[model samples]
Target: MQRRRFKETSSLEERLDQEAMRLREHKLLPPGWLREQAFRKARQMNIAAHINEWLASPGLRAPI
Candidate 1:
């Protein structure tokens, strides 16, 4: 087996922003499983992004 990797042309913020917008579009649907699926993914993505941001915040370090 072989592993493949490629460069990401967009920044993390840019990618997340685009994905968020895409998920929001799902809300236009009346009601269905697809909308729920998108909602869950969006929620997970939002939470993960926030958690990562908090973990990387400078306040997490011991005070000097």
Candidate 2:
């Protein structure tokens, strides 16, 4: 089996922000459970991006 890979044009933070903003523009975002789930996913994505950045910091990279 093979998986397809492609280059991403935007940063993770940008993509997450765009998703949140798109949801905010929808009226259903406030009262719809489905949109709520999407919002939660966006938030989780942001948290993961931050964690990845933290782990990739120069301070964390020891001379091993």
Candidate 3:
């Protein structure tokens, strides 16, 4: 088996800036506060989905 080496990646801020520029170019960028709110909402939804999946999996059981 060959081991894969990971390369260094850009920082989170850099990635976010790049995304923002893309959005701006496409005229889809939202206001700063709205963008922040949307990010928070997206994170919450992702966490909720993960928790729901864990609850539904067969390996775990609920206590009576």
lDDT of 3 at 56: 75
* Candidate 3 per-residue C-alpha lDDT over 1-64 given as tens digits, one digit per residue, 9 for 90 to 100: 9999987597444455555444345334455776666666555555665666677778897766
Give the per-residue lDDT of model 2 (tens digit) for 3-61. 99999999876786777666555555457787677777767767876787788789998
The digit string of per-residue lDDT tens for model 1 on 10-45 reads 866567767877897899987999999998888777
Model 1: residues >4 Å from true position, as ranges? Answer: 1-9, 62-64
**Which consecutive 10 residues in model 3 have the weakest lDDT in total?**
20-29
Judged by lDDT relative to the true structure, which candidate is superior, 1 or 2? 1
TM-scores of all candidate predictions against the true structure: 0.67, 0.59, 0.48
Return the clash pairs for model 1, or none.
none
Give all candidate RMSDs, comma-separated: 2.8, 2.9, 10.1
Best by the TM-score measure: 1
Clashing pairs in 2: none
